[model samples]
Target: MTGLLPDNDLLVQFSQLFQQRTSLSNMQAHWQQYHWKETIKLGFSNHKHEDWKYTSLDRLLQYRFNYAQKLKISKQQCDCLALPLDSHRLVFLNGRFIASLSDNIYESYQVSSLVEQKNIPVAVHAEVFLHLTESLAQESLLIRLAAGKKSNKPLYLLHISSGQTDNQNKNIINSSYYRHHLLIEENAKIQVIEHFVSLNNQSHFTCARLTISLGDNAQLTHYKLAFENQHSYHFSHNDLILGNHAYAHSDSFLLGANLTRHHTSAQLNGKGSYISINSLLLPFREEICDSRTYLEHNKGHCHSQQLHKTIVYNNGKAVFDGILKVAPHAVRTDGKITNNNLLLSKQAEVNTKPRLEIYTDDVKCSHGATVGYIDIEQVSYLRSRGISKTKAKQMIIFAFAAELTESLKNKIIHQQVVTRITKRLKRIDI
Candidate 1:
């Protein structure tokens, strides 16, 4: 109540509630203490801060939301949120893991529920809201892959949020605050796909954080898919750390939520490590979405690349901020960052910035951003090819996104992403 978002009485109240619940939650004692202190120190985000200037969480503070203590739904409802058949899956409802609805694996991997464990791994966190998320989450999802092995099948995680299913808790609005931790041993390779969805039209808020650690010579592929309802709010953060010779690739598709914000931070901790961050953000109607990323070259021979593309239609808005930093000792580093935007309506708006901070003169870094309308010549060419004007425009926009999608290594997931994106484009009337 004494910090940034104190002006909103609802958020202030929720902060107090979360503070009081920390003692009752199952999180480890040491982490609880750390989170409590941090939450008290870093209260809420405001529009005045440069990092939060383009987005506002003030209006969302107008509504009150509660934590999910008990579930009141059937198995069939949970099944609606799973992935394709026979896939390794984990499901969470309102931030609590559901084992019965999950697939018990027999692979050379380990899956442990943090709520039932005694120790939690170190997290990759940089923002203030992260403290609040840790203070409220009852338990986290922990996944570990064995060393020197390649996963035969990709893993899927489904997070379902339905506001207050039981009538007895009708006055308590439902919200989820969860964290996920992933660890890959040396010479291991894994792929993870995460889906966030809302089961009902009720207004809910989902705040989550993920931390990934890759050992030497490890590789990881991560995909984030957001398809929440317009009545819901979504906030997420992913922190990745790679060791020597490790590789990481992250893909994000932001297509829903009334108000959404995503933060991705990757740290190249050892020499010869690399990472690539790619995202496609499409917002229609009155939705507002923000994507922020930071890549740190901590050691020599490290590389980072970012490609962020967004399409804003109707009165919707999008924001992108990308930063690349090279340490003094991180010589021979290579980095490139670019942000491209397509605006369909005069009412649509975008704010994009690509920043580079280098402490070493032996690094190569470049950054740029572009915002433009659909190319008329390209549209004309498509139209001449027997395509309608609207269809041609849609095709151009889709092609822009395909640059990122076509690079996906998983053929099934690539097709699914394309299909879902096409459906959303059609709903916007091309």
Candidate 2:
């Protein structure tokens, strides 16, 4: 195929699947068709693209992944992967929602599987994967919190990917697509956690999209946990919009997948809005992790803060690209971004870029990045205190990551995050 359209095996497979699926509204079908054609015209990005300079899709595009078939999984299987928190759970297996496995919500909240709700705008992006998701997604979810109400418990959305087993007892490579939307009305508050995991060590591909809208004075706390297998590939996009005096806090933990990319964009469209985003990435062995964030200050008296940390080991690589832009009318805008990376091996690599674009002279903005190895001085000090070299190194690594984990206000979630980080850090050599 000359582009991503003519004879691409992945597109061909998804086209067939799309034709066989039913229950799509006329408007939805038209929307999908439009995006599919746009995807073919735009094609995929390469290293030459400014936004994709550090991450390449060559490895991910080489595989011919079939659509993931529905599989039967017990609640026990999901429990093993879930965090110990009291929350209402919504489960999805292989991109299809399982109503039997989900918990019922109260009357104060509105939840449904349909995507044809009014006032929900479709995603428009130049990226190929996003367009593909818009074209091929077979499952969708919409959650709305009523005005002046707050959720008593958090909402947990768990997405699990599992491949089919062949006659030779090997797993088949497959793909799944999903889309989710969350809406918080004025004076409402809610907390949400989106967890991604795998049932087995199967090679698969997952593409997901999430769009969040906060009305005036709304509050939201969001968390995303990605713990897929090392043989899988994952791509996700998040778009957030904040209204007047709205507040939003988002935390992302990336610790798995052979190749992964997360793109997030936040817009402060109303005055006095605030947003804070934090991310932790651990790429070990030959894995690659890429994260990108774009913040737009469209109104005055808005503020934003971002902190990103990455730890690389062996021959792994990590990338971070962040940009904050203030419009001409957005006076009194405050924005700050910091990125720190730790290299555990000489072969490990990190690529970081934090930029600011300001059109208003009254705004305050700063950006910085740092990349270095563990301090030998701290290790020596720990050794003199009768700690073993391996233990000392582990302690330092934990402390480096604790900055983000300790920020979690929920005790159960804080402990769970710390435990996962400790378990992953055990693989590093002293």
Candidate 3:
């Protein structure tokens, strides 16, 4: 692929595959075709791109991945990967919804297939990956919560990537695309968790997008958990729109994938809207994780807070880019962003950039970043207390992650996250 230009081979392969999928209606096909052209025009981001400078796509683009025509996964396999919590579950294998593996829809909320819906929303951003998913996704889900309603349990969206092997018994890279939309009306409240996992150790690629809208006085708690195999590549985009007095809290855990990129954008369009985003990224053994967030305060009295932490080990790398913008009329806005990184290995690296652009007065905004290693004094103290050096370092690392994982209100989810963190830390040599 040329610099900043679309990969012609990949685009041609995608076009051929898109043409073979007969699920889309005539109108839907036409709609998707328009996006396909836009995707080509926009092309993929290169290392020169400011937003992608710290994360390189060269390794991801080198492979030619095929779409999985069929997927085989058992209920037992899915159950093994599911969180131990009471939730309304929807399962997808290779981007296709698996009704047999999903829970029945309850009366408290409305759920429908995107292909069956007459009105399809436009893409929130014009990026290549976002548009590519919009153009090629064969299946999607739309969920709506009515006014004055509240969900008794969280909604769980599970995605599994299962790639096939060639005749030589060698694994062939596979690709999957999926889109989801959620709407919460006035006075509504709900929690959602989007979880991604791999059914096998084969290399694969997954692209997903979720769009959410919150009406006046609505509340939403969102979580994204990625646990794909270490050989996989993953990308996700989230768009959120908030009305007056709306509130949203988002937490993300990046624990897998050889190369992973997550981007989130929130528009505070109504007065008194509030949003908080917290993320914990653990990249070890040559893994790379990139995270970006954009918050726009369009109305007065809007508030936003972001905290991102990364633990890098064994030549792993992490990136964090955050931007907070306050419009001219957005008075009394409050925004804060902070990123902290802990490197356990001399070869490990982190790049963090936090920015604020405020056009109005009476707004309080701040941005900062810190990159450091384990405190030698603390480690010495623990060693003097008869603690092993490795155990002391592990304790400090766990404490750094616990500061954010402890914020999870659900006991089951919190414990599960902690368990994963512990498991990963055990693999560290330190």
- Please name the candidate that would achieve the greatest lDDT relative to the true structure: 3
In the predicted model 2, the residue pairs found to clash are none
Q: Compared with the true structure, what per-residue lDDT tens digits does model 2 show for residues 143-168?
A: 88889999888888889987546635
Q: Please list the C-alpha lDDT of all candidates, in the order they appear.
A: 0.81, 0.84, 0.85
Better of 2 and 3 by lDDT: 3
TM-score of each: 0.92, 0.94, 0.95
For model 3 the local lDDT of residue 140 reads 75
Better of 1 and 3 by TM-score: 3
| Lowest-sum lDDT 10-residue window in model 1 | 116-125
Clash pairs (backbone) in predicted model 3: none
Model 1's alpha-carbon lDDT is 0.81
lDDT of 3 at 362: 97
Candidate 1: misplaced stretches above 4 Å?
1-3, 6-11, 19-27, 72-75, 115-125, 165-172
Return the top candidate by TM-score.
Answer: 3
Backbone clash tally for model 3? 0
lDDT of 1 by residue, 1-430 (tens): 3336656455476666565554434346456667757766665667776777878777676666667555656778877655563558888888878888877873766987655334344555467667767767777767888899898878788888876556564446677877888879899998888899887877788888888889999999999988887778888888899999999999998878888899998889989998999998988888898999988899999888899999999988899998898889999999999999999888899999899989998888999999999899998999999999988998898888888989987877787788777877777764
